[model samples]
Target: MHESLSFLAATYVGQPIWLWLAFLAFIGLLLWIDLGVVNNKDGVVSAKKSAGMWASFSAIAVAFGAYVYFVYEPDPLYYMSPDNLNQQAVLQYFTGYLLETALAFDNIFVIGMIFTFFAVPREYQHRVLFWGIMGAIVFRAIFISLGAAIVNEFTWVLFIFAAFLIYTGWKMIFGGDHEMDLNKNPVLKFLRKRMNITDTIENHNFFVKKPDPKGSGRLVLFATPLFLALVMVEVVDVIFAVDSVPAIFAVTKDPFIVYTSNIFAILGLRSMYFMLAEAVARFKYLKYGLSMVLVLIGVKIIWNFGLYKGWKDMTGEALVPYLEPQWSLIATLGLIGGSMAYSWIKTRGEQNPA
Candidate 1:
């Protein structure tokens, strides 16, 4: 009996099996409540309701971060002192969460664009985004697992990730306007060729059986614009993950921390999307903040690597200082908050006029 219990609690990929299962169950419960209770009906979600939902999900994420601080064994392997380990793990989780949430705003922009391009109605948008979130969960899991494995094997990959982040951040700040032209999107073009699609939405159904467009006396499956919107949403997330997954890896290498933070940020994104979609144009400075975050994290990764090598060469003597996870978290929050404040003031001034 003791051996069986011990086996169930055994560590896999640096976390106990039970921990992983608990996290999964918690996420499952949230999804169930979201789809089954809070938003069971097919109706347009008002901005006020979306705001309340965002707050609820955001609070849950913060609580989970607090739970990590209190319950998790920070240094199970005893590498760092207990206090330092606890601080580092908790700080890493929050930093990863904040960074991911900030980066995810870019996704909101893309999602909004996709829905507008498809002319998706407000009520049906939730259904597409809900399914999109489901796909994101699976996709992020695979990305995180693969990323953790690769980084663990090749430590130098961190440098590459850092460099990529720097490049991406610079481009975002200086690049021309990013417009999503559905006509130019290869995925949508391909789908159009491969599937029979309807010209209009069919009451929130992704696919509906209809009389064959070819005038045959049989029913055929036709993909609705809603499904195309969902597919585009999924594809956009995959594209964004190329940057976001690496950005989080720059924060911490712990698969548990990485995965949990990523999932929590993503879990709230659908509600966040609805809440901010109509007001996206108001936050003009948000991209600058997001750009700065990526660049800061990239620099932090490189700085830490330099400190590690310098410490080794100096025979345990400290050389260059490294940016701690806590400081990184502070900087990220400041940048995001400051940018939001600036955006609000500027927009308010413009609205009122001198």
Candidate 2:
């Protein structure tokens, strides 16, 4: 018993193992409540319900940040400490959460496209999204772990991530929105070729046993269009992670911080999708705003990379030092907010054009 307690007390990725365990347990409970109680029936999720879910997840995220600030360590009292680093952690959490949520807003449009391409029914979409999020959770963990390992071992690699973010952000800002041709997606084509896929969704079931078309009267499990949509959604998340995981690392490299903020942001976005699915086109200019957010984070990373390497030692107390987390949070909020407001107004103008 003592050994078990001690083991829980052990630290991993800058946090106690027990903290990680508690978080996973909390997330599990939330998923149960979501799928078992809130959405027990597989009907169309209303925008009002989506808003409520988003609010619940956002509130949970805020509560977790408070927990981090006040109770995670619980040794010297984080906020009152001389250095006040605990407060910094809370800001980083919110910053990372906001950044991730904004970056992933584009996903709603993509998801809508995926569902349309597959002709998935509204009743079945929830199940696909639930399983898709499950896949995302697993894949994001792997990516974060690998990224954490690579960055911790070789600090220079962070700069490469920074460069990648800059280039991607530039593309996002300048590159006009292009329609994705799911028909040409090689992943979809490959899955269709390799898997025993059904022509249509099979009553919300990912896999259904159907009679083998061969003369044998045996039942064979076949993948449904629902499953294909789920896989495509999962694949889209992995692609988004390539951009977001690095961006969050810049916010704060604490894997726990990065992972929790990321998953919660994703959860929030999943719910928000239902709210915005039909109206995603109204906020079209948000693409630039999100892209600029990435660029800003990249610049922050580059500055820190240079500052810590040799500039800090040379400048000593004279330099501005690392980019402050609070300012990053503020800048992120301002950029996103401004973009949202502008997009809404422009969209309204176009719709009401006299």
| Candidate 2: residue 213 Cα off by (Å) | 1.6
- Write model 1 residue lDDT over 1-354, tens digit each, in one string: 888778758886788888888899999999999999999999998889989998998999899888888888653532222457767888989998998898888888789888889899888899999999999999999999999889888888999999999999899899957687889999999999999999999998999999987888899999999999999999998999999999999988888888999999998899888898777767888888888989988888788876655475678865666566888899889998898888877887475322
Model 2: per-residue lDDT, tens digit, 1-354? 887589898877667888888888888888889999999988999899999999999999999899878865532321212366777788888999999899879789889999999999887788788878878888988999898888778877878888988998899878767878988889999988888888877787889998997758999889998888988998899888989999998777778888999989888877988888877888888878888888888888877666543476686542445566898899999999899998888888475322
- The reply for model 1, stretches above 4 Å from the true place, is 1-7, 75-83, 214-216, 310-314, 349-354
Tell me the lDDT of model 2 at 159.
Answer: 86
What are the runs in model 2 whose C-alpha is more than 4 Å off? 74-82, 314-318, 349-354
What overall lDDT, based on C-alpha atoms, would model 2 receive against the true structure? 0.83
Whole-model lDDT for model 1 versus the true structure?
0.86
Residue 202 lDDT, candidate 2, scale 0-100: 76
